[model samples]
Target: MKKLDLTKQEKEIVEHALDHWQASNLLDVDKVEELKQSIEEKGFEWKTLARYAFWVALVSLIFSVLSLFADDAMVRFVEKFYETPNIVFCLFFAGVAVGFYVLGFRNKEKYPEKTFSNETLMLAGSFATAACIGFLGQVLDRTTSHYTLLFLLSIAIYAVLSVKLHSKLIWVFTLVALGIWFATETAYHSNWGFKFWGMNYPLRFTLFGILLTTFAVWGQKRIHVLQPFQSTSYVVGLLYTMIALWCLSIFGNYSSFDAWTQVRQYHILYWGILAIALSLGLALYGMRTKDNVSRDIGFVFFILNLYTRFVEYLWDNINRTIFFLLLAVSFWFVGRWAEKVWSKGQSSER
Candidate 1:
C-alpha cells in the first residue's frame, strides 16, 4: 500500500486514535503497528499549501469573470445586459450552476482524487445558484424586503444538492442558508429592528443553535442518510450556541448597546454565570457521551467565559500590573493543567 504522508499533528492524532482503538480491542496490536508504519509524518504541509492554492485559483477565476466586464466596451454591454429582463440573468446563471454541478459530479466519478478541484466546482455552482435565486427574486418585482423568501429558496436548493451529492461542503452551505433565513425572517417580522420577541441576535441564535444541535443528536438514528452530516451539524450548532452564549455573557440580552451601558456591567452577573454553567454542563456531557464536538466547544467556552468575566469585573478596579500578573498566572495554570491531562492520556495509552 502507498504510504500516507501526514503532518506532525495529524500523525499524532492518528497514532493516538489507533492506540485508543487497540486499547478498546477494536484493532489488534499488529494492525495498529502496521497502520502506524504506513503513515509518515512530514515537516512540510503540502496539503495546506494546495488548499490555499486552490482557493486562490477559485478567486482568480471569479476575478477573471469580473475582468471580462472591466473594459469600457464590456462595461457598456453589461449596462445594456442589466437593461435586459431579470429572467435572462436568472436563466444564464441557472445554466452556469447546472454546468458546474454536472462537472463536479463527473469529477467525483472520474477523478475522485481531485478533492479540492471537485469541491471548488461545487462551490462555484453554489455561488451561481445563489445568483440565479437572487435574480429570480428580483424578477418578481416585489416592494417589500422579502429577502427571507430568497434565503428559504436557497435553503431548499442547497439542502437538495447536499443530499444529492452527499457532500458535507454543500451541507454546510445549506446550514448557513438556514441560518440566514432564520435571521432574515426574524428581522422581517421585527420590522428590521434586528430583534424578535424582545430577543437580540445572540439570544435568538443561541436558541436556534440549541435546536439544531438537539435535532442532530436526537434525529441521527431516525434519518440514517443524515448520519454522515451529524458531526458537522453538531460542531456548527455548538459553534453558534457557544459563540452566542459568549456574547450573551457580555451583553446581557440588551437589544441596544446604549441600554447595556445604562446599567453597571456587574448587573449582568447572572448571564455570565449562566453561560459558565451551561458550558461546564456541556463539557461534562460531552465527556460522558464521548462527543468531542461538545467537549471542545464546552471547554473552550468555559475558559472564554472565565477570561471575559475576569476582564469585565477586574479590569477597571484592579491595578494594571496586578491584572496582567493574574492573567499570566491563570494562563500558566491552564497550560499546566492541559499538559498534565495530555501526559496522563499518553501514559495510559503506553
Candidate 2:
C-alpha cells in the first residue's frame, strides 16, 4: 500500500543483492545483516555507557556511607588532596567534590563514546559530595550563617538533580534540607517562644503559610494536580506556619505563665488546667470539621493552654511533686489515645 524510504547505502545493498539473485520482491539478506551489525554496535555502545553509570553510582554510595562513620578521616583526606591543609576536615570535603568532576572529565576524554552517561553520574556524585560537606559544616557548628548557606545550596542542588535524574526520591532530600535550615535558624536565636515579630519563629511560619496558600491557590487554578514545586512549597509552608503558631501562643504571653506571677500555685493550676481543656476541645472540633483556618486559630489557644499547664506543674508548682506525677499521667493517657487513632488510620489505608 505504502512505499518505504531506504537510505542510499540500504538501496545500494538491496540493488546489489537483486542483481546476484532471482529475488526482487522478497526480503534482502544483505539488508538484514547490515541491520544486525548496526544493532550490535549500538548495543555495545549502550552497555559501555551503562557500565560507567553503574560504577559511578556504586562509588558515590560507598563514599557517602563511609563519610557518615569515618567522617574525620574523610575530611582530612579531602583537605590533603585539595591542599587546604589548615582545616583538614573542611578542605578534604571540598577536594572530594573537585576530584569527582576532574576525574569525570578525564574519564570522558578516555572513553568518548561513553562520555554522556559517565558525566551524568559524576554530576550526581558531586552533589552528594557537596551535601555531605555542608552537613558536616552544620554539625561542627562552624557558623549559623554558613550552615544556612550550605543547606540552601544543598536544597537547590538536589532540586535540580531531581529534574536531571528524573528521580522523585531526590525531593525527599530537598525537603529535608529545607526543614533543617528552618529549624537551625529557629534554634539559633537565644530567646525562647514569642519574641518580637522580627525575631520570632512563628512570624516566619506565618509568612511561609501565606506563601503556601498563595501558591496552592494559584497552582489549583493554573494546573490540575500538584506539581513538584507546588507540593514542596505547600508542605514546607504549612509546617512552618503550624510550628510558628505553636511557638507564639506558648512563649509570647508571660501573664499566662502563673509561675512568673505572684498568685498561689494551686489556684494557678486549677485555672490553667481548665483553660487548657477548653482550648484543646475547640481545636479538636475545628480539625474534625475540616476548618483549617479555624483550626490554625485554635492552635494558638491550644498552645497557650499547654504553656499554662507546663508552668503550673513544672515551673509554677515545681515544689509540688504530686502535681508533676498527675501531669505526667495525663500526658501518657493522651499519647496512648493518639497512637490508637493513628494506628486505625493506617489500618484503614491498608
Candidate 3:
C-alpha cells in the first residue's frame, strides 16, 4: 500500500470531521453537510464582511433620516383612520421581520456566511441604532412611542443574532431584555408595599426569581469564560445582597430610629457607625487569617451599609448633597484600611 496526501478541501473536511467528532460521538449524515456549509461561510475575509457592514449602516441611516423628515402626514392620517398607531407600528415590524427572513432565504447562496451578509449587518445596525434613538426619544419625551418600539426592536434583534451568530453576547442581551420586561410587568400589577416588601408578594417575587435565575446562568457562563469564578461570584453575590437589603429597608419602618433622629439625625449616624465598625472588623480578621471568603463577606456587608444611605433617600426623602460627602469619606476610610492591610501583609511575607 502507498501513502497519499489529501487535497486542501479534503484536508479541511477531515479536520472538520475531527472537530465535530470531539463535539459529538453520535454521527448523523446531515452533520457532515452542516459542517461543510459552516466552513464555507466562515472562510470569507473579515475586511470584505466589514465593507458590507458599512454599506448596511449607510442604508439604515438614510432610512432613518427620511423617516424623520418625510411629511408624517401619511402616518398621521393612518393614525386617525385606524385609531391604533401602536398596533400599526407593531404590524409594520412584523412585516419587516417576515420580509427580512424571506430575503435571507432568497439570497442565501450570495451570502454563504449568513452572519457576514449585508442584511445581517443592516439588522444589527438597526437594532443598535434604534435602541439608542429610542432611549434618547424617551429622554426627550416620556410619552413617545419610539421608546417602546426601540425595546421591541432590540429584543427581536438580539434573538435573531443569538441564533445566527451563536454568540453568547447576543444571548445575554436577550436574557437582559426578558428580565427588564418581567420586572416592568411585575411592578405594573403588584401592590406597592408587598411588591416593595409585605406578605402577599407573588408578582414581585416572580420578577426577582427571574432576575436571580438569569444571574445564575450568566454567572455560570462567566465562570467558564473567566477560568476562575471567584471574582464574579464575589461581585454578583454582593450586588444581590445589597438589592435584598434595599428592598427590606423600603418596607421597614424607621419609628424606633426616628426616636433618635429627633436629636439631629443621630440614629442614622449610630447605625452608620455600627455598620462601618462591623465591616472593618470582618475585613481585618479576613486579612489576618488569609480568608478570601470572609473578605468577600465583609465587602458585601460594607456595600449594604454604603448603599443604605442611598436607600434612605427614598424612605425619609432627603435630597441633601451632604450624603455624597458622607459617601466620599466612608470610601476613603475603606480604601485606607485596604491599603494598610495589604501593605502590612506584603511586608510580613517578605
Candidate 4:
C-alpha cells in the first residue's frame, strides 16, 4: 500500500507517536524505521518563497500601471482617447473586463495550482469593471455625486460575478463595494459633515461592522446558498469593526484634532472599553463554537486595543523610561501566560 504524504510537522507528529509506541513495546525498532521511511516529509520553504514572490510581482504590476500616468506620451494618448464618447469608453473597458474574466475563469479551472497568476488576471478584470462603471457614471452625469450609484453598481457586478464564478476574491471586492457605498452614501447626505447621528465616520463604521457581522451569522443559518460566504463575511465584518474601534478609541466623535485634544483621554475611554469588550465577547464565542478564525481575530485585536489605550493614556503622562519598563513587564507576563496555556493545550491533546 502507498504511504500517505506528510508535511514536516505531520512527520514529526507521527515520529513522536511511533517513538511512544516503541517505548511501550507495541512496535519494534525495525518497524519504527520502516514507518519513518514510508512517510515522505516535504519542506514548505518553497511555498513561503512563492508567496513572497507573488506579492512582489503584484506590487510591481501596480507600480507599473501607476507609472503610466507619469509618462507624457501615455498621458497624451489617454487624453486623445478621452475625447471619444463616454459610452464608447465604458463599453470598451467593459468588454476588456469580460475578456479577462473569461480567461481567468478558464485558467482557474485548468491550472488550479497557478493561484497567484489566476487571481492577478481576475483582479485586472475587476479594475477594468470599475473603470467601465466610472465612465458609465460620467456618461449619465447626474447632478449629485453619483458615487453611491457607482458603488452600488460595483457591488452588484462583483456579487453576481463572484456567485457565477465561485470566486471568493470577487466576493471580497463585493464586500468592499458595500463598505464604500455605505460610507459614500452617508457622506453625501451629510454634505461631508463630521456628524451623522452624532457619530463620526469611525463610529458609524463600527455600527456598520456590527450589522454586517450579525447579518452574516443569521444568513449562514437561514440561507443555504450563503454557506460559502460565511467565513468571508465574518472575517471582513471583524476587520471593519476592529479598525473602526481603533480609530474611534483615538478620535472619539470629534471631527477636528483640536476638538479631540480639548477633551481628556479618559473622557473617550468608553470607546476603548467597548472595543475590548467586543473583542473579548468574540473570543469567548469562538472558544464556545470552536471557531479558530474568530478566536484568533478576537485575541489579536484585544492586544491591539490594549496597546492603543496604553499609548493614548500613557504616552504623554509618564516618563519614557518608566513607560518602557512597564511595557516590558506587561509583555513578560503575557508571554509567560501564553506559554502556560499552550503547554496545557499540548498536554490535553496528548
The 10-residue segment of model 3 with minimum total lDDT is 191-200
lDDT of the structure predicted as candidate 2: 0.57
Error of 1 at 129 (Å): 1.4
Error of 2 at 10 (Å): 59
lDDT of 3 by residue, 318-344 (tens): 545765676778779878977997798
**TM-score winner between candidates 1 and 3:** 1
Please give the TM-score that candidate 3 achieves against the real structure.
Answer: 0.37
lDDT (Cα, tens digit) per residue for candidate 4, span 165-252: 7788888999999999999888877887877777789999999998998888886658766678888998998899888988898889
What pairs collide in candidate 2? 78-92, 79-92, 202-244
- Of 2 and 3, the candidate ahead on lDDT is 2
Give each model's whole-structure lDDT. 0.89, 0.57, 0.52, 0.87
The regions of model 4 sitting more than 4 angstroms off are 1-3, 14-38
Alpha-carbon runs more than 4 Å astray in model 3: 1-88, 91-160, 163-168, 184-241, 250-301, 304-332, 344-350
Q: By how many angstroms RMSD does model 3 differ from the true structure?
A: 14.5
Tell me how far the alpha carbon of residue 162 in candidate 1 is from the true structure, in angstroms, after superposition.
0.7
| Candidate 4, residue 337: how far the Cα is off, in Å | 1.7
Tens-place lDDT digits, model 2, residues 164-222: 54334455566666666765656555343433345445445556665655665475347
TM-score of each prediction = 0.85, 0.40, 0.37, 0.89
Which ranges of candidate 2 are over 4 A from the true structure? 1-156, 164-169, 175-197, 213-233, 249-308, 311-314, 332-350
Q: Write the per-residue lDDT of candidate 1 for residues 289-348, one digit (tens) a residue.
A: 977878888999999999999999899999999999999999999999889977986786
Which candidate tops lDDT? 1
